[model samples]
Target chain A: MENPYIVEPAAITSIRQETDETKTYTLKFVERERTLQFTPGQFNMISLLGVGEGAFSITSSPLQKDDFEHTIRLVGNLTRAIDRLAQGDIVGVRGPYGTGWPIDSAKGKDIFIIAGGVGLAPLRGLINLIIERRNDFGVVEIMYGSRKPDELVFTSEYDKWRAAPNISLFLTVDEVPEGFEWTHGRGVVTNLLGLSKIDPANALAFVCGPEIMMRFVARSLTIRGLAEENIFVSLERRMECGMAKCGRCMLGRAYICTDGPVFSYPEVRSLPQNLLAASF
Target chain B: MVKSTPRALKLENLNILIDAVSQKYRTYGPVAKDGENAWEEVKADGELSLGCAATMLPAKHILQPVRLDLYSFKSSGGFQIEEPGFDEKIALFGVSPCDVNAILALDRVFGGRFVDPYYWQRRENALIVASNCTESAEESFCTSWDTGPELYSDYDLLITELADGYLLEVGSQRGKVVVNGLNLPGATQEDLKEKASRLDAARAATKKRLPVPPDDLHQLFEERYDHPIWVPNAEVCFSCGNCTFSCPTCFCFDIRDEVKPSRKEGVRNLEWDSCQLLEFAEVAHHANFRRLRIDRFKHRTIHKLSWMKQQYGLTGCVGCGRCVRWCPSWPVRRGRITSLADPVEIIADMLEPPEKVEGVERPGGVIV
Candidate 1:
């Protein structure tokens, strides 16, 4: 019998602090010969063994062999416990699950990548893929924002991403503290959209953020002339069994664990309740 | 395999037949407990509640234990999954057809996409001795769904209560093995006819009914998705989760890791969970998707009636009436009747919204 819940032990190779509350972990299966095969935008169920499991996106480039990264924000019991760990700590890994971003659908199209806070972590995989095969897609624009400038993640990788041909980066923050040197848009992420030059008719836009933020991003893109089907957003819910049997991740007919963590704007709108708001 | 003739055993000799069956399997049956029956291990010497009414919990507990450890991780061993193979060959006696239907519903859920090997392991090992209802319990509405009074199929041994003897219809080869060489008299054609008429009488005795056919429930629910009765119902609902706990087909679960004091290792366990609880749908950052009492309440009924069909091509509720019996809310007034968390009443209210009608006095609580 194949036990889906059994976690494979993986040794943490490295950890990098992204913000006061968030860190990126790089891990590889301890068996050494086994490889973590995953496409861009899919997620892995990271287990601290004693603490519990959490579903986080594979935040590294899929083109990279052996290892994958997860950018985790210290939120609940499991993640905070994850923060206490150091390099060489052994953790459990179970996935590479769910539908990934529609890379094939986005091929030969202008691309727009939108992120807010740690939401950028999920898109990082696709961003790396785009950089590696820069000629496969049209003009690529990345718009990312954090509440504060210091909260931005992967700051070291910004220069390398900007160096990719036909790829542009638009960074923003909600606010900045006193005596901080901030040279970026100073508002919500949507404000940075004004700097984008991609034609909506020829582009596919992917958005991820706080639910409210993703809701607004989808609306703004629609107003900017992108068809509802062409705009995709990733959603999160309380998930236990990523197999979709747990029933925790349900949103209307969609089990956020199975049918999507990623859904096009039209599909989101077709669901019964508003995932983006407090109302029905 | 040849179709075996139905057999007959005198009611007094039931214990003898059970003794014959016990040699090859672990027998489970309902036993009297505090005025109600409960599914329990039936020792060869112990009594069986053969003609008893509904049990508090269904036979699902036997197949899927309330708290089964999925796996354990040790500092020394690294990782180990709890046994995924069930070794016991068990036989369940007098399992109601509604409960059998519920088990089948669960099979669809666990069998989808990635099959649940743990559940399938135990479920596949067990043999069912299904029994037809001779009488209806207070909360039963099984006839409306055609899920009780009798089962057409899906059991190993089908037992029917007759006046002077037990009419045993062997449905599978395993059931044939249990009754081999018992020398019980073969059932006459007239005896099978008697069982059919008795089953029909049992069906007629279950007075409660749904407003629409079971096939149309999903569509009807979809049309009445935002029916006004929900808010008032939520106000009365205690959210105590009694309904879900007693429910036959409520398979939602929560997984927890229990680590030892040494912090060296732990075990991950899967246990029954209810959507009625406020925290069932809460994700990170204290954001609960189904935050409102009304949201949770609607989710329970809608998921059972509508969403289950969408996901698994079956009704989540098997018309067992467990939720109706266990819901804590009082006087859930629907069209022409009152019952808490009753699927029939809920659908009846959708057919005729009680609040819309004038001068309808609610039984205990107000909906108008």
Candidate 2:
């Protein structure tokens, strides 16, 4: 079998700081012929060689892949190393692996995207893909919540999304700082469900965020009449191999690495694991 | 078309054959100490322990080591992927037929799905020489699973100890090549029939049996998906994963990348993994799907009996009884088969004995 751990070197062309701790890095392969081919919601394992290797989702849309983007939060040792990297620095990349969002099936359906904190990284790729092909999709509604006003990511893109026709964007924060003025929805992301006028029967929901937030979002959508299979959630697990050969990412007999990083609430419920619970 | 005969070689010749095989391959066999049993690489003829019941560790280690480096890389744009370098050929001497069957079970697992090239390469290059059981062990229950002390298709050579010498039977083409290359005496038709009869008697000698029917295990486990039996049965589990690591057919592994201090280079390693671990089903956001110990415990059993069969067309458990022997919990025991619902009667089926058999003969006919 071919070794799946092999990584090609890629250079960081630009770095955009999304929040205080998260930054989106645009990487172009050092060898021009070897551009990364990945689905929108799939992730890559990035390594700093001596630092360590960590899994990061591809935040850039597959529809536009002149250069790939990975939005990394300064969390662990590998992410900390990534944060210190400047433009022109080289990093090792492997994958574009795991299952991505079922965008083709979601076509013509009213899309409800719910994201929290850095969990929005993977969903951002789907959102961008939908916006590029705006007419192909039904009503697009984005409801995002962060820990604080300053913690919200993609501040620059928010204006562009708001300007788009037939799209609705609603933002929320747990607490607004002293100097910050907020005019959008307040409290949690799930609380904004009442604001959505789209029909749940004709809509597909994509949720990514903390386990608690996703559980609430999925439950609320299901109660609102969306089928369990129509509500998709992005799951995260510590994965070493993007292939099913590694047992680390298994949810019962299903290897999340191969079967899903994306799954419907019904499939997740059938799994023996308690993924819906706030505390695993 | 005369029946192949069985012949005996003096104990001294057996030693010479082992030495010759060791020169070409990494030879392994059962070695007994005063306190423990182990399978280790034999450097000389004196280390072989044909009388031991079973090695504390299964032969799975030879094909899949406890830890193996899959690939290594350097940040300086240098990378290296390592494949199993089994050029030295392998000879497993004194392996019991049960253990040989265990190896066959592992072959189905690793060779079945994804075709683990690493395991396939080592298994294809290695050779197995199994010894017939003179006496059954207390834990021996291979007969219950229809794979036992008698014989199966995994071995290259099967050796039975006779009154004056050792009777060898060539099983495969590989065995024929080795036997043809060795110097040994020929056997008569009567000698071969005698060995076959003795093997049949030994197979019947094993009294212990797993109570559950092998074919009905899928339905039994599936029907009892929510049974309370799992809770009490799994209560004593330590979740240490010792059972999985020692099992012959447990091929589940985890892949990890270990980087050098320079942070620019690393090697990805394939390490043995256990489903018993809490993090096995953990996803992003620190959520564990099968977080409860009871759930994890039941999940493994169900997978072995039901899910694995659905995916691979074979039962995950080969009835090796390693897990029953190694588990620290006092409640666990080999052949302690339990059904989710009411137990069904187990019917034992007997097969007719074979008429003719071929015995192995070494070339150049040098006894010792």
Would you estimate the TM-scores of all the predictions? 0.93, 0.81
Backbone clash total, candidate 2: 25
lDDT of 2 by residue, A1-280 (tens): 5545566788899999998999999998886566677777788888776555667899988877589899999876678878998998888788887788888889999999999998889999888888899988999999999989889998889888888778899998899988787897779999989999999989999999987789889989989999888988888767766665555666656667667788877777766554473223
lDDT string for model 1 (B240-345, tens) is 7887888888888999989899867778889989888988988767877777777777778888877887888777877788888777666736324455588877
Off by over 4 Å in 1: A277-279, B1-12, B50-53, B76-85, B332-337, B353-368
Best by TM-score: 1
Q: In model 2, what lDDT does residue B196 have?
A: 70
For each candidate, what is chain B's TM-score?
A: 0.90, 0.80
Q: Specify the CAPRI tier of model 2.
A: acceptable
**Every candidate's lDDT:** 0.81, 0.70
lDDT for model 1 comes to 0.81
What's the residue-level lDDT of B349 in candidate 2?
9
